[model samples]
Target: MARPVWSGTLTFGLVSLPVQMFTATDSHTVRFHQLQRGTSDRVRNKRVNERTGEEVPLDEVVKAFDDGDEYVLVEPEELDDIAPGRSRTLEITGFVDLRDVEPIFFDRTYFLGPKGKEYTKVYALLEKALGEAGAAGIATFVMRNHQYLVAVRAEAGLLTLHTLHWADEIRDPRREIDNLPGRTKVTDRELKMARQLVDTLRIDWKPEDFHDTYQERVTALIEAKRTGKSVEKAEPPAESTNVVDLMDALRASVDRAKKPSDQPSGHGGKKRANSGDTSPPTHIRDAAAKRRSGGGGRRKGGGAGSSKGASLDTLTKAELYRRATEASVPGRSSMNRGELVDALRGARQHRATS
Candidate 1:
């Protein structure tokens, strides 16, 4: 095992156990440094003086703060001395039901384990207690010299600690968003149809069922570019679709979800005719074809012309993420789908380049 970055203890009045903190999470993808296109040699970066176009020595550089006009330079070493350090202990302040904590506050997750054989019993006790209570312990711990709020809870037989963002860090939705529908004047028939459609498509979260098709497409694009193959642009869907009478669409969607797709014939992806003139009704064909195109049309917000009725489920996860990147949605920097899903889709499409 590698050496821990910090050594600490979980203190909860009369119960203390030694613990160690290891660097959690890693970049699975390989990293590379920028270099000149023609050469394999490392491209060195020179420290250039901003005012004068000349190289500056590293030792002469100092930290500076700007007041939107002028900069006040301070000795770099002063920053180290002035900045306070976290006390380096996972001090439990209290416990709260895990459900009560909003998803916005969560930042990063880490695992906490007993430091030695002697501390195992106390560690197990804390884990069991938290698990039984269906609660998470709110604790403070120092990692990389900064104090952070962490939620310590038990999962998979180990104590897992999730670092949290401050409450003030989350932006208010009311500020950026305006002119949204209040009650959405949906008809009872439509609501019933929508509910029935949701039921037909319900399935367990089999993660394998989902894959980053965008990433796969991107990989294919990179390979095509490398091999000098023509990267054909996909045809865009028609300019528009109507949004009125969603109930009729919902009714069709329920039937589509319930019906199994026709078996494939030996003819490249063609459906074998169980019955003549049986081209899956127009709506079903459109929905399935959209899936094969990797939902390019949905990402562009043109759902066959229904400008006001774009849906997040209309696109795949990868398409949604691509739109999020293009839209430059806020906090998309750290959002996981379960929380960011439907909300982020519309947000990204409408958000400005802030």
Candidate 2:
């Protein structure tokens, strides 16, 4: 069973629906404690007074809210006193087009379902109504002593609640973009090549397709470090990637994006790391080149179809994943490699008809 982090009733108009909130995301960053170089003991964080150098207990900490221009220190109990509702309810004051709400307003998301099995009908009814209208229920629900601008929308077969950020929280892009020049006009040739490049690189966007590449590389690096491997520093890529001629560079980039088999593929390739979590693109290219030279083909005849068949069906799902790593497919760690063989097959068939 899943745990509810917050319990409250969702209220909009006369309808009051009970609900619970749970976290929608998790982090897997490796944690390390500060440790002395020669000792087995771990280091501890301490809060000490700068002047007196006295250690402070955790309970001694207090949050200070900025009141106007001054800092107003308040106690925990005081915050509890101001908790959003004496009677738990989400109040929907108004509704607006989803497009009207800028992306900056979105903060977090949570799944909202009927609080109990008894509210099943109500849940379905709400989900259906929201779906048909193509409208997100703009509502405010109090959770964890604070009120949140939450968008209630039905996804798949369930109610999903997305928490929105307050207007004050969003940084003004114009402030950072100050003094930016107006757009430069492009020639017909430049525009044509640019569009061609974009179309060539375009692919169906599935959130699961990509991953935290830097994280995976970092993890690999850490593992390599633990194994006592050394990493060499690399020279940087060309500083002036801006081309002398726009259309010519775009044409070159498009051709380079293709696979050696003459297939019009995107800018995706394998990479190799020096016993660390991070691998360089150049290293991956080098490895691929070396493999191609040592063995004429990974399959029979060096034909596209035969090579794909060998690559796809040569091994089980795990083997395909290994091959994909050899191919430098992104987000490999987050995948159940064996299951992907069936998935890729289905995806390919679907794409062919569509």
Q: Which candidate achieves the best TM-score against the true structure?
A: 2
**Quick one: how many clashes does candidate 2 have?**
9
What does the lDDT come to for candidate 1?
0.62
Which residue segments of model 2 deviate by more than 4 Å? Answer: 49-51, 65-71, 231-240, 258-354
| Model 1: lowest-lDDT 10 consecutive positions | 270-279
State candidate 1's TM-score: 0.62
For residues 268-345, write the lDDT of model 2, one tens digit per residue.
532221122222233234334444466344435543213344556454443344344444444443544334565566
Give per-model CA RMSD: 14.1, 9.8
**Residue 153's lDDT in candidate 1:** 88
RMSD of 2: 9.8
Candidate 2 residue pairs in backbone clash = 11-90, 105-165, 217-277, 217-278, 220-276, 220-277, 221-276, 221-277, 317-338
